[model samples]
Target: MRDASAVITKKLYEEDAYRTEFDAVLVSVRRKEDSVLDVVLDQTCFFPEEGGQCPDRGELGGLSVLDVQIEGNEIHHYLEAPKDALPEAGAGIHGKIDWPFRFSNMQQHSGEHLFSGTVHRRYGFENVGFHLSPSEVTLDFDGVIPEQDIPELEREVNAAIWSNIPSVVRMTQREDREGLTYRSKIDLEGEVRIVTFPGIDSCACCAPHVARTGEIGICKVVSMIRWKGGVRVSILCGKRALEHFQKLHGIVVQTANDLSTSMENIFPQVVKLKNERQQLLARLKDASLKELQYAAKEIASDEEHALLFSSGAELPAVRKVVNALCAEHPGYCGVFVGNDEEGYSFVIGSRQLDCAGLGRQLQETLGSKGGGRPEMIQGSVARKREEIEGAIFSLTRP
Candidate 1:
């Protein structure tokens, strides 16, 4: 194992200078059991995923910096490398990030602050939770806001964006920060970064954010539902918000054309069509049952055996009919078979016969197994009609 002390360094707060790119000295390298080295730099632009914010992704010294983590105010950089001579502790290194991804995160995170702040200010709703992931940023409110109010909230937040209000980040002493409140669920022990969206929202957050509300472009409330005794709102901000609208607009147009109706009337038309389809299905099912009942009466065998088999009907329905018929005729044997998604279900019953022994005979012949009382046996098997009939005939042979 390499010296752990040589591989840890100070975490540079990069959001303070979001656009800057610079080099740093290799401060240490810690070797792990897997042979990969954890390299530390004297200063870094890599932001570790913390405080509900995702980690900054970038490369260092032409090698992929797979992860950035903070331990006791020190930042450790996990790197990907095969076994090779490691860079010296004091070696100079270059670092760069895919700026687009970083900038997008900044915009989305800032938008969340504004949205959460506005909710807090307008409705006294606390932001109880937050998650900044690769796909979307989500926030959970501490209380429910009515469905009718969501669009109004969206409008107000975007109005702030259109106003082009400048956002400011300030650090204040604990005493001076008193009475000047912000949204934070966790207790803060030291200096805090207070992000303020002017005339709109404010919160104490460690995540990187854009300089102005207008930079967030558009804010969209994609979904809102009750969660954890409160409400959870999933939002798409900046480029994500724009992309969501574009995709939904395309779908709306396609649906309207397919239905030969205007987009405005699509919902009512769809509801009407669905109602008609359900009614037709119900009528078809009733007619099929009536036909089955007629067929059952015609095929009622005067012989001691009652055979019921149907490919068109569901197994459950066929079994119910067979059970009813068996209950009506006490001495006769019943065998019900029907095709289903699981291949077939065969139910055999006779008040006077040892059906368990018959079931065992069927299992041995058809490679299936099930058990029941001496008078009735029920089970399922994956077998064709001919194969099942042959098995049953062999068990009942004279």
Candidate 2:
């Protein structure tokens, strides 16, 4: 019921301006079935999600642009339709972005380059991976870096920031860049946009970047893990770095208050508390085992079979008690307990009796599942405790 032939113009480089209001003529419009109006401007400043950096978000003429994508050379702006009717094709429209969000992304992305470049330059480590997300930017390096060297690397990157080096964006012909030095993990064979972090890093990229290295503000390494024959470094930059510090400071304060200790001594206090709790739990487990042993003596049946059912004992404790009881008695001893979210678990064993046949019969009768050696079997069932008991009795009574 709507026209499909509108024209729009796209402005390719709006990120260069820290803040700008722009106007463009509608180049074309295509309506998808989901009610999203795919409108294209002859030119646009909205950067599409490309080269790992997410797209810029903003509004066009008061309509929310939910997503932006590049198909071929045209940048498609997906926006919600007005209640009355869609905007006509060929109409001029204004576009703007949330500058703060865009600026934060620029800071984090540029900071990642400096970090990666410094690591590579100092240790001969290759950057094997990179991810730029809304929350943080992460880089993976090819080898383990010593803990003592991390501070030095951070200092090196911040030193570049202090230098106020110009972040150059250059377009060079493929042949003209023959001897130029840059870090490229993949082969690039065409005309490319090179982003250079002055003396720190130079790489071919198409994403929008800040004007100067100092604009990156700061870079912080949060964690490092060995991965894929290499080390993965998790990092936060600029605003995110500041946010991480504030969050950790708040936690330290809250922990200190809860433990009735000063912030300066919280670390040692927490370590002491953890050690004390572990010792107490170990003693409790030993006491529980003694009680279970005494309980087993009273419940041991004179008949050939003994059955024990408990509701809340942990799985490991139940298993320990069941195995000990079966070893002491020659007849069948089965233990049943409720598992966390997993309905019920049964452990059955016998010293002289064949438990494998009984275990299979129980599984088939109760519609349950599990298996073990010829002398013992353990598994879970979906039925209630009463239903499981009824099924087990039916299988074992004969």
Candidate 3:
């Protein structure tokens, strides 16, 4: 609304954000590519991508508007079309904004303001960064937030939403502002657009937001990760939050039913299953190691090298057998576990030959991956067992 006479495109979005359609005349048109057109409108309801909020997408003159961007005073609307079908400059056109997309973005953006404002007031932390995508929204803060206070922060955020506070927007002159406190990432010049959430936040922004906090439905902080010198918090708001909860609930219900227990007992049951699996794996590994060691003693090792293969054995068990064989045979010892189609987990050792060089040789020739010391090496290869055995036996040839 700041001196519409000075700007070319009349941004109808600034007047009424809820307005989804508008009639506008084309100010200019240029064909950017064979099927792509850049059309500027005299007035538009589609909001351009600004202030970290994504562009509003919809149809303009029956052509799909892929993106909307601001270049100085003009809002460039990127459209798809054939050259013959494009509207000429000065021609009137209909502009439609996708309401659902706009509403979802508004919910998340406004929800973030509420949360950021509350955290800033309570913890003295600044919101340094924000990103909103279709799948996730993340806010980066300038200071660490205590983990114990997160629940309290969530409670406060939900409380502010439940209060159904109205968000106010004002355009102020740059010089008229004095001794006024606000959150801004940069020092904006000219006319400044200030968005205020009463008793919660006042920040400079150029994006459309929900008129009331209650429209955001619910705001849930999903994750927090240590970032730079501060913390990054991930959140889901409105419909996204509801969908996330439902998906998780479905998984919990399925798991509880499968275990023949209630949801409350799912955690203990999963932990018990995990512990049982670990104990079984340990016993199986011990038996495999003993069996491999006994088989290594039984092999006729008059030659300088020996190789053995086991089915479905772990890498650790293979390494144990290789170490024992190398201690006894003194030349080259190799153990391969798993079938040829799935590749083999291999361990090679030698007190005499260089196992690292052999591993490298196999890697270069057979496209295998792994490495270790000269005396002992571990890796995997997709080559057939016969090919690997032939290569090992060739080293023992007279």
Quote each prediction's TM-score: 0.83, 0.76, 0.86
Residue 328 of model 2, lDDT score: 72
- Which residues of candidate 1, in runs, are more than 4 Å off? 1-17, 33-36, 246-262, 294-306, 311-320, 323-342, 345-347, 356-383
**If ranked by TM-score, best first, what sequence of candidates would result?**
3, 1, 2
**Candidate 2 runs further than 4 Å off:** 1-15, 82-85, 124-129, 140-147, 170-180, 184-192, 226-231, 262-274, 300-305, 309-332, 336-346, 349-369, 372-376, 380-398
lDDT of 3 by residue, 105-171 (tens): 8999999999999989998899999988767899999999988888999999999999999999888
lDDT of 1 by residue, 1-398 (tens): 33545455544553463754658887777765365668777788888878877887778887777777877656777877667847777779888866787888888888888888889888898999998888878899889988999899999989888888887888767886789877788877678888888777777877777877788898899988899999989988888888889999999999999999999999999999999998886776566556666666765555555655554454466556666666655443544445644556666777666878887877788776677887777777787776776767656767
Q: What residue pairs clash in candidate 3, if any at all?
A: none
lDDT of 3: 0.86
The 10-residue segment of model 2 with minimum total lDDT is: 1-10
Clashes of each: 1, 18, 0
- RMSD to the true structure for each prediction, in A, is 3.7, 4.8, 3.7
Better of 2 and 3 by lDDT: 3
**73 in model 3: Cα distance from truth in Å?**
1.2
